[model samples]
Target: MDSEVRSYRTGGDEVVLDLTRDAADFVSGRGDGLLQVFVPHATAGIAVIETGAGSDDDLLAALGDLLPADDRWRHRHGSAGHGRSHVMPAIVPPHCTVPVLGGTLALGTWQSICLVDLNVDNAERQVRWSFLAA
Candidate 1:
């Protein structure tokens, strides 16, 4: 198994950062295998979604509706409703495994790997990419 961990500064805002290019770069020159993308943060998650078509915004809106960032959570610490960020992984999940053929990710035309972060207290995030040869 080959693996690498990448870190990024997400700033203090909710975002859906695209990571397709990074994944491609990591698997460059590699062969068929499974690409596992995992986030080592409880307040963040990994998601495969259609981006740049308002889908990202729609996702954030849906999350807001489902997990409003208000003072209604018991796990209060950082920002109000920061606990919702921890609960995000339950719905979006913290990892995703995609098929890599000929060193390329087998994702759909609009599907993109993104880092979903809602935590306003932390600005740094790490994503681990592990490839298991087939």
Candidate 2:
């Protein structure tokens, strides 16, 4: 079975979406060897980051500097906004692959799967998680 998410964010400053529990719970209910987490939005990317206050802020701040949204980017012509957000896909990957061992996700001590939304304002985002046999 696959899980579909209707995600709403309070604000964007390294908000942690602990897919560990969600993924493990899903995997436990089905046959799994590997878990694939995919976010089908160009403005968002997926990564394994430490779920902490400082870490979250650092990640967002770094991303902002890496891809300044206010820069004179040609992609911002259409008033759609989030030109740098589109460029973020080039930085972090669109999906993540984690090994499932003993019917649970194997992650480092502080590692947690996160779906990063780089948009300016809050909008309903989509996150898709699927478990497959290794």
Candidate 3:
């Protein structure tokens, strides 16, 4: 097993960041295994979806509909509707696992790894990448 942590500045807005290239790079030449992407944050999550085809925005939109950023949350703190960010993990999850074949990511043709952040209060995010050889 091998692992490392990488940081990203998500700024003060909701974002869907593509991490496919970096994920691929990390697994490169590592042989068959499993690549686990984990975000160590209460208000963030990892998602595997199609990007650059409006899907990213669509996800955000759907989340907005499901979890409105308003004062209806009980875990109120930081920015408005911040509690929704906490609930997002339940829907999006904080980690995802991808298969590696011969050191390459075994992703679908249109699939991409993305970092989903809904918390506008935190600007810094960290993602832990772990590879376990099979």
Candidate 4:
């Protein structure tokens, strides 16, 4: 298992998180396994999607529509102005596991790992990467 931090500088933003080695570190370098990607935060989420064709922009727009940042959420009680970000995470699966073969994340040729940061702060995000090799 390995963990890394992705720091975002904007609210309502989308970024491509490349996880090329998620399956490689599974200790055996070869086996049947699960690649678990976790976003340990209340206002962020992880997803596997195609990296192009304006997919990132489309998701950003969709999330904004679903959880508009301008809305006043109870979490706004704190310094953060938006609360829907947190709400969104609750519904989105923070942990994503993929089948591994030959020690590689066997995703589609165009598929990519991504992180959606919905908070209004420039800070560090903890992304926990784990693998269960068989």
Candidate 5:
């Protein structure tokens, strides 16, 4: 297995940063295997979805409706609705495994790997990428 952690600056706002390119680069020439993308944070998650077609924003909006960042949460500490960040992982999940075939990601044409960060307190995030050859 080959593994590495990469840093990303998500700023102090909620965002869905695309990571397909990075993941592809990491698995390039590595042959058939599985790529595991993990975010070691309570407030962050990894998602495989279509991007650039408002799907990203729609996801955030859906989450906002589902888990409104308000004072109703008991896990308060950071910004308003910070507690919602912790709950996001339940829906989005903190890790995802993608199949790589012939050194290429076996994802749909419109699909993309994205980092979903709802925590406004931290501007930096680390994603661990591990590849296991088949």
Candidate 6:
């Protein structure tokens, strides 16, 4: 298994940062394998969506509707409803395993790997990419 970890600053806002290029770079010149994208955070997740086409915005809206950032979460600690961020992983998940064929990701034409971060309390994030030969 081959792996690498990288960190990014998401600032103090909700965002869907693209990671497709990074993943492709990681697996560059490789053969058949499985690429695992994992976010080492409790208040963040990974998502595959069609960015630059409003899909990313739609996802954030959907998540807001499902997990409103209000003063209802019992796990309250940071900013009001920060606990909701912790619940995000259960809905969006913290990792994704993509198929790599001939050193390229087998994602749909419009699909992209993104970091779904809504936790304003924490702007630092770490993502790990692991590749396993097949």
User: Per-residue lDDT of 7-122 in model 6, one digit per residue for the tens?
Assistant: 98999988999999999999988899999999989999999989998999999999999999999999999887798999999999999999999999999999999999999989
TM-score (C-alpha, index-matched) for candidate 6:
0.98
Give all TM-scores, in the order shown: 0.98, 0.81, 0.99, 0.77, 0.99, 0.98
Residue pairs clashing, model 1: none
Using lDDT as the measure, what is the rank order of every candidate, best first? Answer: 3, 5, 6, 1, 2, 4
Which stretches of candidate 3 lie above 4 Å from their native place? none
Regarding lDDT, does 4 or 5 come out ahead? 5
Question: 2 or 5, which is superior by TM-score?
Answer: 5
TM-score for candidate 1, please give it. Answer: 0.98
Q: Is candidate 3 or candidate 6 better by TM-score?
A: 3
Output the lDDT of residue 56, model 1: 91
lDDT of 4 at 77: 46
Error (Å) of candidate 4 at residue 17 is 3.7
lDDT of 1 by residue, 18-91 (tens): 99999989887789999999999999999999999999999999999999999999899999889999899999
lDDT score, candidate 2, position 64:
72
User: Per-residue lDDT tens digits of candidate 3, residues 1-134?
Assistant: 89999999999889999999999999999999999999999999999999999999999999999999999999998999999999999999999999999999999999999999999999999999999999
Pairs clashing in candidate 6? none
Q: Which whole-number lDDT from 0 to 100 does residue 120 have in model 1?
A: 84
Q: How many clashes in each candidate?
A: 0, 0, 0, 0, 1, 0
RMSD of each: 0.6, 2.8, 0.5, 3.4, 0.5, 0.6
Model 3 residue 119 lDDT? 95
**lDDT, residue 21, model 5:** 99
lDDT score at residue 105, model 1, on the 0-100 scale: 92
What is the C-alpha lDDT profile of model 4 across 8-126, one tens digit per residue?
34443344454544434542465666777788788778878776778877777787787776647777743354677678776556777778777777888877777777665635577
Residue pairs with backbone overlap in model 5:
69-81
